[model samples]
Target: MTRHPEVLWAQRSHKIYLTIALPDAKDVVIKCDPEGVFSFSATRADGESFKFDLELYGGILLEGSKINTGLRNIICSIKKENKVWWKRLLKSEGKPAPYIKVDWNKWCDESESDTHDSDDDYIRGNSEDNDSSEDDGLLYLPDLEKARRN
Candidate 1:
C-alpha cells in the first residue's frame, strides 16, 4: 500500500510554506494550474508513494514558485499572484478548515510584507483575540442552541 507523505503548511504575507516528508524519494512531480489548483505526487525508492491535491485561496505566480528539498523534506514556497492577504490558504465552501500549524522557528513575521495585517490568532492559549479575527479558530461553528441551553 502506497502511503501519502505527511504535509505541514503555513502562509505568510505573500507566499505559503509547504513541507512534505518524502522519506526515500529523491525526485518529485508537481503540477499547478493557473487557477490555484495544486498537486504533488512522488514515488520513493522503497516504493512508498504520495499524492495530494487542493485548491488555493488566491491565484499564484507559478513562474516565481520555488521547490527545494532538505533532509528528505520537499519544501515549496508558492508566491501569491495578487500579493493580497488570504484569510485561508485554501478555499472552503462552508466552515473554514482547521488552522494550520505555523513553524514559527522557521518562519519570520514579515511586518513589511504588505499581504496582510498581523491580526490572526490561531494559537489556542490566546482566546481574547479570537473574536477579533475573521477565523474563530474553531474548525466548526459552535451550536447556538447548545450554548443557549448551557
Candidate 2:
C-alpha cells in the first residue's frame, strides 16, 4: 500500500524543483505542509501503489508550490518564501530524502500560472495523461485543491 518512488529535486537561485518518477500511476495524490513537508501517493492499473514523505529544505510559499504531471513523472516547482537556497534539499536534522537525477529541460519558467493553492492542510491531484502538455513530452500543470481542513 505504501512505496517510495524515485525522487529528484534541485534548486535554482529562487526556486526548488522536485520530481518523482512513477510510471502507470493513476489517481495520483500530493500534499504539502506549510512548514515544508511533501507527500504523495499513486496506484497503478494493477493495484500497485506508491507513497513517500519528505521535508523540504525550507518553508515555501504555499501559493507558489505547484505540481506538473507527465506521462511518466510528476514535478513540483516550489518557491522559497525566504528566497534562499537550503544547504540541502530537506530539513537539517535527518538523512535527506532519496534523490535522483533530473534532466535540465525539466526546469520550468516563471510565466506559467501557479496551479497549487492550499485552502486547507492537504491538496490532491491525479496522474492522467490526456493533457496537451503531456503530448509535448513535458509536464502538465495539475490544479490542486486542499484535501483537508485542520
Candidate 3:
C-alpha cells in the first residue's frame, strides 16, 4: 500500500525511526528530527544507522509559508540497487527522477569524475551548454549539529 504524506506519524526527538520496505531489497529506516527534517539509514533493518542528508532542496516544507511552504517535497538519488524500487515507491508524491545525488555520496563523486576529462565530448557539451555549476549534491549534517547550543 502506498503511504500518504498527510498521514501524520508520531513525533520523536531525533530518534524515532520509521521503517519502510523497498520493493525487492532491504528496508530502510527513515530518521528525522523533531522539526520534521528527515534522513535515511540502511545499515540494517534495526541497528547502527548512518544518517544521510540527501534531500535535493534542503528541507521539505510541511506547511505553506509566506514565501514558499506547503507539503514539502523530499528528494534523494539512490544507488543502482535501490533505484528501481525507489522509483516505484515514490512514483506518487511528485518525486523527481534522480536529478542530483545526495544520498549516494560515493556514487555522486564517481559520476562527476569525468567532468574534467578533456576527450569526452558529452562532458564538454554539458560544460558548454550549462555554464553554471549544478547543485553540489546534498549537504549532510550530523544530528548532533542540529542540537540547540544553549
Candidate 4:
C-alpha cells in the first residue's frame, strides 16, 4: 500500500507554498494543472511509495510554478491565477486529509501581506542603523543586565 507524505501549505496573495515532508525521496513526480489539480508521487530511500492528489482552492498558473527538491522535503511554489487570498488549501468544504496541514512559519494573513514585503525593504534600506532600538521585528531575549540593574 502507498503512504501519504505530510503536506504543509501556506500562501500569499499571489502564490502558494506546498512543502512535502519526505526525506530522501526518489523518482519524484509532480504535476500541477491550470484547473487547480495537483498530483505528487515519490519513493523513499527504503522503497516506500508515497503519493497524494489535491484539488487546490483556486486556479493556478502552471507555467509560473516551481518545484525544488531538498534533503528533507520538496517545496513547490505555485503561482495563483488571480492574486487573492484563499480561505483554505483544498477546494472541498469539509476537513482536509489527515496528512495535510498548515505551514504556520510561512503563513501571512491578507492584512499583513502588504506590510510584509515593505518590512523587508525597510530592513535593507536601513542596514546602517545598528541601534538596539532598531531591531528588525525579531524577538530578542530580555537584557538581563538592564533587568538586574532595575
> Using lDDT as the measure, which candidate wins?
4
Decide which is better by lDDT, 3 or 4: 4
User: Worst lDDT window (10 residues) for model 3?
Assistant: 8-17
Residue 31 alpha-carbon offset, candidate 2, angstroms: 0.9
Candidate 2 yields a Cα-based lDDT of 0.62
The Cα error of candidate 2 at residue 121, in Å, is 34
- After superposition, the stretches of candidate 2 with alpha carbons farther than 4 Å from their true spots are 97-150
RMSD of each: 13.5, 11.6, 18.8, 8.5
For residues 1-150, what per-residue lDDT tens digits would candidate 4 score against the true structure? Answer: 899999988777877878899999999999989999999999999999999999999999986566767678887878889989899999999999999998777777899876653334222211233443332222123569999999
Per-model TM-score on C-alpha atoms: 0.63, 0.64, 0.19, 0.77
Summarize candidate 3's per-residue lDDT along 15-120 as a digit string, tens digits.
1112222222234445433233455544333333333433322223322111101123222212222111122122135644343222222221224434422212
Kindly report which residue pairs in candidate 3 clash with one another: 61-72, 64-69, 65-69
Best-to-worst ranking by lDDT: 4, 2, 1, 3
Best by TM-score: 4
Total backbone clashes of model 4? 0
lDDT of 2 by residue, 1-150 (tens): 566888876565456767788877789999887788888889876888988787777887877566776667776777777865467776767675455454344433333213222211122333355332222122434345543432
TM-score of 3: 0.19
Tens digits of per-residue lDDT for model 1, 1-150:
555676667666767767676776755888887789988888888766767787888888887576655456676767788766577667766553333345543354456444233323321111343344332111233559999999
lDDT value, residue 142 of candidate 3: 39
Better of 1 and 2 by lDDT: 2
| Residue 67 error, candidate 4, Å | 0.2
| Residue pairs in clash, model 4 | none
